[model samples]
Target chain A: MTVGRKLWAIIIIKIFIIFAILRLFFFPDFLNSKSDTDEGKGDYVREQLINRN
Target chain B: MIDQIDLSMVDWARAQFALTAIYHWLFVPLTLGLSFLVAIMETIYVKTGNPEWKKITKFWMILFGINFAIGVATGIILEFQFGTNWSNYSWFVGDIFGAPLAIEGIMAFFLESTFIAIMFFGWNKVSKGFHLTASWLTAIGASLSALWILVANAWMQSPTGMEFNPDTARNEMVDFWEILFSPMAFNKFLHTISNGYVIGSIFVIGISSWFLLKKRHILMAKRSILVAAIFGLITSIFLVGTGDGSAYTVAQSQPMKLAAMEGLYEGEAGAGLVAFGILNPDKKPGDGEDAFLVKVQIPSLLSILGYRNTEAYVPGVEDIVNGGYKPWFEKIPVEEKEMTYSVAQKIEKGKLAISALRDYKTATRAGDSILAKISQKKLQENFNYFGYGYLNNPESVIPNIPLTFYSFHIMVFLGFYFILLFIVMLFFVNRTTLEKKRWLLWISLWTIPLAYIASQAGWVVAEVGRQPWVIQDLLPTVAAVSMIDTNSIRITFWIFAGLFTALLIAEVMIMVRQIKIGPKEGGSK
Candidate 1:
């Protein structure tokens, strides 16, 4: 590939790493997790965001 | 459903989405109109072989490139957010909303993305006719993508041709044509694209006027002004017509939103439009205090605009809460058809829907077919106002009226102001006459930021007016959010804010530098 194409590829890869890959590893899918019951999960968010204040 | 949504999570997710949308908008309007403008210029150049038209087209093309890049960057995050921040909403309407987005990718995005490459890279490689076709196709592609997305959004506001699939626990499309050609969606697409057209016209006029002011590129700037003025004027007229259609739709599908937008607290037989008014801050629903502080109203205009006739009843906040609109739905046969349903009635129905769902869940697990059947029947019957079940208080249905009321007025005022601006520009602008009128040129230059403000304000009116609803009466905004920790969203929100801000600064610096360079040197950069 040409140098221009190579540079564009690297730029795109860096963006993908920052947005997609890093997010998947660092930000767990709290919503989809099976550890908590539906009510327990709902209550957790409600308490943390709204009723606490 | 008994519990109110996690307010903090919803608020944070909304904030993040708003940030992304606002940033994305900054680039989209320019891309929408400027692409077509550039194409028109190129068309002129090819037909006449005018070097001047080629230079003008190249100059704007550079700016469009700068704007389109940032728009795409911000746009990807917004799409990702549908899966992350609003997972519940995604699941609920995925069967319906996903179609348009998919079609947008297959039809609009491919058309735009393929041709845009040809437009930029195939300048000398392809024949002039082929290149011109690519340019027009790119613009059409961008517009078609917007059409599908707006259709999806409009479905949320006025959901039509869709049915609740109780077995699947989501809405399913019964008719694709109905979804695509809903009157509300059609009007929305027309109105929104016209808005983009106006923005593009202003951008061309503003930048060209700036060049004129500097006594540089006077001839090219004049031609640009002439084109944008004629185009802008025509679109501005259409913008007003579609605005009327939007108001009419709000009256029919989301009356509560219209009531909030007008700051009307009590139903009236002949309601007048608020020509201009300050909302009385102390006044709220159930309070007897007058809603507006200082006001000017056009008698019966709202009634005419809302309904075709002046005598048609317009429900207000009090009417909504006290059961005015319930009577309209009573003609349809239902198990719970009463003379009228107060706030209490709606809440009971909403609670019934929620309870029925819970029973169905329990029955399914226990393998109790009879119980599941009974509960599913109840759930389907009262599912119209399912979002209402989450409200702790009946009064929670009222949107933030002060914000909606003012936003709607500000948008309207600016819209009419733009028409006036367009008329003045069109009348005064000539080959050389516009060059001399420094004051008019100054107005054209300053009108740029106001055009942006008006566009943003129009969205505010639309979104804020809907209030509690994420999908009209079907889903509340709070319940639609993913059950994520507020802190997680907050941290990312700030990160994106900083990142997008930096990109914006870079974009502006590059744009300003290119504009300063003029056509000859700027095109290469």
Candidate 2:
């Protein structure tokens, strides 16, 4: 392969590893499990801001 | 895209958006500016048939390509983030905000993307005239993109051409043209793009001055410096007018933002402009303690600048919160607008609206038509300030004052300083004095970062001053996040930060190496 092709191959692989692969394993939606309804979610937000520990 | 209504959710989302915007900005302004510079150089090359000019154009073109590539990469994330992080905001204002973004994609993106290839690789593949057209089109495309995005942003600051729909729980467009050509949008576009022009000029001058310092590309450096300085000087002066127009728009549409930007806590008819001041952090307005630790001000200047009247009352944060600015709100178009809400009155009205929405929901649940109709009337009447109802405390309405105030002042001070620097440089440019005056060259070289900083500060004053509410009176940021893990957001923020930083380092290294290589050596084989 040419140097240009070699560079492109590594660049694509690096970006995929960092952005796509790591994201799936590490970042899961935690806020969804916190509450069910919108009102309950709103209350949680207010309490966090207004009555913070 | 679900509502993640929590503080950490909001914080992490905000952090991610801010990080992306900050990184995106570091690249976008240069692309905006350099594209035109390269186009101009290419035009010169085509006109004069100078191989030297072609080489010069190509050198800058290479830098532009590197910058544009990263800018495009960062920009996609910003657009996507509305769905990923600010899902609620997307749904709420989607009817209004979605249109401009769609236009930008269709109009600006296609034009830029199509022509940019020709600009970069079309040297001998396309005819000479066609190549020049591509270069110009690419520059115009970059600018056009800025216009559409600013239109959307400015609409958020001063929401015109849209009305609240109680049924949909959203703001819908009433007049497309009103939103597109809003006074706020026009001012923002002009001010922002001109700032980009100034940034471009400074970038060229700064890099050119560096070449002069080392005496490497002295002829090209001198030519670049002369060209950029003239362009810089013109735009720098015009920025004052555009900046004034921005302040006026803010005063008329977003009085609280202007008040917070000034750190004024009390209403004054003839408020003086703060020249320089130290704000006393502990100072409270009603307590009668002066907010200024040390202040020097031009009397009545703020009132005149903000309201164009020495006697026109400028309402401060305290006045706004305490309902003293009711007249100001009443003055905003017709009292016919459901949105003409003063500070306390807005929250009260918003709570009523919220109550009505609940009632409507309850009535619907019971299948009671009559009750639903009654609740709908009340909901529609007070729907404008519904976002304010989410607030538990009135004080939450006040943005972080010191941050807003300092950012505004820093932007202003640095702006005037740039103008003065350009003026002095313009004076000495033709004479041998420019090269002899090492101090000016050194200052100009360093001022590049400050120019970028001023642009960022201007945005800070704008975005920070409108705090709590992401859509002015329409939506608070707390209610605008996607349902996601705080760690998820945190992880993404770090990932983006890491990637952008790595890319930036690589970019700087490449740019530096290319710059050192000079146009002659770096020219295409």
Best by DockQ: 1
Docking class of 1: incorrect
Evaluate model 2: give its lDDT. Answer: 0.78
CA deviation > 4 Å runs, candidate 2: A1-53, B1-5, B326-342, B521-525
Which regions of candidate 1 are displaced past 4 Å? A1-14, A21-32, A35-53, B1-5, B325-340
**Chain B TM-score for the candidates in order:** 0.95, 0.94
For candidate 2 chain B, which ten residues in a row score worst on lDDT?
B325-334
Report iRMS values in order. 7.2, 7.8
Which pairs clash in model 1?
A: none
> How many angstroms is residue B507 displaced in model 2 relative to the true structure, after the best TM-score fit?
1.6
| Top of the candidates by TM-score | 1
Tens digits of per-residue lDDT, candidate 1, B189-300, equal 9999889989999989999999999999988898888888888889988999999999888887888889998999998877899999988889968879998889998888
C-alpha lDDT values of all predictions: 0.79, 0.78
